[model samples]
Target: MRHPLAHALRWSAVGVLTAGLMCTGLTASAVAAPGSPPDPALSTPGLPPPAPASPPAPASTTADGLALTPPMGFNNWNSTHCRAEFNETMVEGIADLLVAKGLKDAGYRYVNLDDCWALPERDADGRLVPDPVRFPHGIKAVADYVHGKGLKLGIYTSAGTKTCDTAGFPGALGHESSDARQFADWGVDYLKYDNCNNQGQDARQRYTAMRDALRATGRPIVYSICEWGQNRPWEWAPALGQLWRTTGDIGDSWGSMLSILKKNLPLAAYAGPGHWNDPDMLEVGNGGMTDTEYRTHFSMWSMMAAPLLVGSDLRKGSQATFDILGNREVIAVDQDPLGRQGTVVSSSGGRWVVVKPMKDGSRVVALFNETGGAQRIATDASALGLPGTAGYTLRDLWQHRGYNTAGTVAATVPAHGTVLLRVTADRRWAAHPPAVEPGLDGDPLAVAGRTVPLTSTAADLGRTTARQVSVSLSGPEGWTVRAASPRTARALRTGRTLRTSWELSAPPGTPTGSYGLTLRVDYRAPSGVRADSTLPVTATVVVPPPPGESFLSDLPWVSAANGFGPAERDRSNGESAAGDGHPLTVGGTVYAKGLGVHAESELAYYTGGACDRVTADVGVDDEKGGHGTVAFEILADGRRAAGTGVLTNTMPAAPLSADVSGAHVVRLVVTDGGDGIDSDHADWADARLRCRSAS
Candidate 1:
């Protein structure tokens, strides 16, 4: 979890800024750098360095001949942990789907069970027992069923006295030999050993004990160390396990995914064949992000050569989920025989160029956009370490299209999306059409009955010039689009772009949501080869809050992402469902109007520069019985305006107010307080924004 300090506070004291008023000056303490030292209370003792600036000596492989590439499998923890739906039938159904849905053919091979698979206590023989209700057929029977489909079975256990689930099933601490033998007897093929209730034991020694025990059983069970990167497993786990988790549990949101990726990016040198870095699991079908964001997640994971464990429920997966998880081209990058992980070529302003060398001398280039809006990301072949060539073959892996490039690889990527391409040197590339990528400029937000100007750019990035280039923009039905400039050109020279401006008008009754606008480009090559490309643009229609003071909950949000479940209105975040929470309560006080959300949550509203200030009573919700910690922040147009120091349930609700003058977008963010997000139910009580009528 990210626990950066808040931005400069304009008001000297809380509650000083009244409704419809603005504060002008900043407090010295509040204006300090946001990168203060980590809170002592939240620091883990005896932990290794989080991320080393320079790479260490190359790690020796385990030589176990397992996980030669990153493991591709399904884990049941993310979608249904310890729930009734995670029963024997569900496991069998997943195995059946792995074969039926073509996932097995795509290289997914393991069927793993997470925590809560065992009974709370060991039997009279001092051996762990399977939960009768969850796995009625027993462990061996389930293993046999999975093996019948040519898949492997993986089981979970903690290195401490109890597993991570609330039920605290028996762990394999002092029973390593007995437990390893038991797992081998049951035909287990993988072990996910976690770190919890560790009894202050040394991480390396404990994990090594399990390693030797598993090897003694003469079974090739792939070892996965799940220590959450507290002890820098990448420095030592390569010779002990096939993979080691480099971060805490992954949440199904763009922020969570991006945070973990940033953590894993620096440790690329520690990854190779038979041992790899695990950035937790895939959240493709978990429904916390859009399809475009999911594609980014998959593309980055594949680029980094991380494990491809399916974390969504297979029995209820959508076609989009299958499409992302079963992308064979991306999967090939992950399972490439070269066993090399991608390294960052350049990163700036949330635009990243990551290149991974393939076994065949080809390079997998990913143009990733992490900003909140569309932007052009580009890189040349020389930057990718490829030798000079007259022409290069550029394959858009996601679009499955090929083009002849003079060396430039670029795309106009959407917010939180990626454009994956494979580049290889080819001299006979003139036979294909030039790569003309489409992009949009200017703001994407439009008000009902208002005209918003937008520019569409078509860039020719290939060996041959694009001839007779034509560009057009189209929106939803009943919406109007009129070009303000010429929409066609005689030719688009290589490395050049043609721009066209348009006036877009939405109907007066247009709904306040995201609408798809298409940018289509058509061109021809000198060889008479014609090509056309269509890019999807998202335009958000927003209705700003009305004048005067209004409860924040009463206004429609432009976007909302929660760490756990959905953000509730006038209630406390209870679990993973809407309308499942109780009345909003913080420090024993109940509020009728507020937002209840878990830490690592974000809610954005289009203020349209109409708001002057926002005030709220913020604190951790008392529903968790004084057990959670969180921090609150207010950002006006991506610049922090106010923040609350770490707040816990034990404290009373803190008053907060922030200046929002001339801000187009106001965001309310809640983050876990240094520690992981466990029971971090946060609330913005009596939240109100004072705004003027939109011009």
Candidate 2:
């Protein structure tokens, strides 16, 4: 996603960074403009636009022979969005986690840094350099650190003049060769080239320039072109890079993942060995989708051979996520020697049958149910182009069980879920393995700092006495679950149900939000091996920040009060002020540091503490339009705490303090004064609250 803000920081030959002298709280859509070719997806009915004339094709990226299988690893873009998380420490932490958890053993390599790497301007020699503050030891040192752990380092750059200046990162516009040489010099193993600040330059020409530059460096960097798939990279990208994005940035939800899948579904033929299609990074462990949905997502992506650069905070991943992402069997299908992408052979009544042919004479079929509820779907062997054989065996990859292959392969698939079955010939029918269905009695929701009861049950679905029936609760960091009886009856006999329960709570600093709770049941059949289930449950914890002055940027929810426009968040301290052209000043004071955004913003807090002091610094935004007169106030339970009597840009922050010992609600408001409301980038700087513990 090339933020519109980047285009403002174009650099002059002398390496000076300058943006336009303007400030209006006006924002632009990240979406493409009308009449611009919609980021290439199957066109909506009757809205097909004219296709472009075929351009001359460049030599295939196969000449370089990289990303033979879609690259697997982690990228920082989604997890941190170039904020504090996009740093050397974070990258190192990810590498450490990957190694600690055996993800490296499962083929997850390449810890890629997405955007926000370099300082805002080029060096005196017009060469790009790392932001000394973020990468203090330099890019080479970071690469060496990663290489020491048997992992590769991937970096980001823009194909345009300026990278996303939104993060103060410089670009490789005219310094393609310099940047490429610098990257090779740093031992970079991969590059994610973005399409920001290109100034309407031709995408192909610019990307080709970087490709040639990288080749000239005589290094093997897996090139990933991230132009938001605007030009249908699948049709023309094979010659430019190992893989190309086939759509805009992906959202971390069923709708978003499915949408990206649908778009890339039509382009599967274009994905093969050496050159593959990318549908953006994986959001598997993120909070948007359920474990079932992630399973479907991972299955689909692997079937399509899409790169699996995970986007979640790996250090916070649960066992379920690690299992889904580190499944060597599914990954093997994706990284099959023949490198053939899967194709949806049939779809009807909301059920889909996708088949991928492996290098060995076997086929991986996925029965997908996209309906509102569970559905029993069947598959046609002929549809998969499988050789007619009577002794084919069905291997349930996820369940680690086997069943007889049927011409009409059938399974009762859960809603929005998938049943991935790998079918192989030259085998006899075997009895299906014993299975266990694990689930929680009720999905619970509670406030932070409060305990909730967790009750789970395991039902034996086969005639197998499962032993060692125990249910363990797992969640992301900051949460813990303690069970009264985490273990079930010594053994769960066939045709019986075993139940276990737990008490779970979030610690003091756990932000109020929804989190995932996984119930991992470890059970074994009489033979000591059959099947086990990992069911995911959800919990919503609501806890306000501690009684102290919490910044708007750190709060859970801050919005426009009384139907005001949405509040703009600028975690990059001076970003908002600079956008408006002023020395980042707010509330009568100057802050050299954190999130400073224009106001028309309101923050709500639970002010039930015993202490009484509350204060807020207020002043006009520093940018050009940020100069308009604005009003700032601190209110408790709809009453005023402090206020700045209409301040202008020239004024420093006016301090407003109030006492609300018995108040239950605290609100901070930044609104424009009566004038035309221009330059009303009000800053509610340094809002603070003093509290006493209630014993």
Candidate 3:
């Protein structure tokens, strides 16, 4: 069977680019400059003439051929990102953590080092050498150390005359053969060859040069081609490298990850046991995205059969990161011997359904919620390419739960969350009761006027097929439920199932809160038994909080919470972040902590400051978090007024006032001090604004 990503949205259809690819905003650092001043990343001091290239070695026969499966391990690029921490010590720390954290037993074997590992110049023998300050023990020592711990080692280099980083590290331009031998001599098991300042060389020829070089070394190293998909490597990447990057570098943000995922979702055919599509590294513990978003990141990468190279400070990782990285069921999907990459099968209302076939003939189905709000995403077995309407037994991979599906399956996916399950055909026979799971594919969280999708997966277990099955959602007064179910029941095939939907809308008058919701599935089984009277499962309907007060206050305050950088309000550090969405709150207080563990919060929008002057008491939200120091500020137009220099722990509210005369908006900015943003939930307590005069 053709893989979905490879055969769909092929390069021929997208009009492959020459050398430049539109990266949108997420690819700020993905491109390489033309022959300009030697990028610091590309320059290396001169050295003695190099020795002759070595002869090609005989082919080897390793048990699991190189990259027969997506490589599981950690890389230093994203997590450290030129932080000066990409060193031997860092690699040693991670190598230790991988063993201590049981990652080794979980199949995470490689410990890769990215760029900036070399000295400013090559050795007298014309060979690359480790920076003495960062790797005093030498490259071979680190490789030996990693190997001593039962893990493989990977390294990075560029195909051009220079590297991509600002430091301009040396490249393999004229020394591919020698460099390959050098890596093999040092026990390098993998190589990430990048595209940077290649002197305008043809990518295919340049990559091929290195590929043949590595092959000649006789080392079973995994060759990773990082060309940012500019030349559409998928068209010819299988022979170039074990894996090839399909897009530019991935930033540690929701938007960046989503953009990369969307770009790679359609190219599954080019991936298999010995070759894969690389989408950069994992950002699970990078503190750039939320825990929920990280889950989506891991799920999508696994489903795509991409390398699971984590790029975080594993030594300092949190439990959430550990769970995501150590998820065995998810890992199994990525390491499936069949090596088939999953592809998007269906999409509706911003929800996507991805399915990958397993070695045992089972299918891994993922319901991804792409919108900022929660959603109901559902898919039928037929849509997943099932031969018949067999009722499938579904196993929630993350939650570790097992249940029988109603022939079709649905899940309520949270914003940036996924419902991943392993589905196997269920042919067991049953008689008597019909069943339905309500609200099966939507989040309990919703906004007024926005459709809160709900699903009912109905089942007919008896020998006789039900003539008709009715499914509907029980609505609140004045709330309308529109359901679409099958008028006539399908035949009672053993594994076949039925699914129906109900989209409910919260009335404009509905207040912000949670309400009860129930769904019913009534059907007559093939044995003439009625299940319409059975009780249905119930879920909650959460209406979102809108603007408190009209045209003046029509828009909810927009917020920018987290990214490793400073919040826009951080005048002291010249740091800024941005997001154009309503703030999230709990218990009537805006939980203004931004993304990641150390986040920033800037809540601002058009506000006449009610009467042209806004006053409020600001402090840390005592109810949500009790730790961390947060600086609070009030700004009107461009003028800064009252502010709380810094508040730590459960503290008293400090008065804040902003003059809004002739101003159109006021902003509340909170910055977590150098201590980081863990538990830095700031509150704009008792805020009040004066309206503009109608005079």
Give the best candidate by TM-score: 1
Score residue 568 of candidate 1 by CA lDDT.
Answer: 87
Candidate topping lDDT: 1
| lDDT preference between candidates 1 and 3, better one | 1
TM-score of each: 0.84, 0.60, 0.63
TM-score: which is higher, 1 or 2?
Answer: 1
Expressed as tens digits, the lDDT of each residue in 297-407 for candidate 3 is 998899999999988889889999999999999999999999988877766545888899998888999998765445667787777876664356667788775555555
Which residue ranges in model 3 land beyond 4 Å of their true spot? 1-64, 426-695
Better of 2 and 3 by TM-score: 3
Q: Report the C-alpha lDDT of model 2 over 1-695, residue by residue, as the tens digit.
A: 11223223333232222222111000131112211343422521111222333434556676667888789999976656656557899899999988999989988999998777788778899888788888999999999999999999999887766665454356677889999999999999999887766667677888889999999999999998887666767777888899887665665545446656766766666777788878888989876577888999899898888888998889889999999998988888888878887877766655888888999888899888654334556665667787776535667778776644434455656657888888776545434433455656533545567777777667654444668777677887877787777466678765577777778887766665557677777776566664456755556554434655555445554222211122434421222223322344653346543234433334555554444877656676555333455576667665676766768778766777878677655666555454223334565556566776632
Candidate 2 Cα errors over 4 Å, as ranges: 1-36, 39-58, 428-695
Backbone clashes, candidate 2: 14
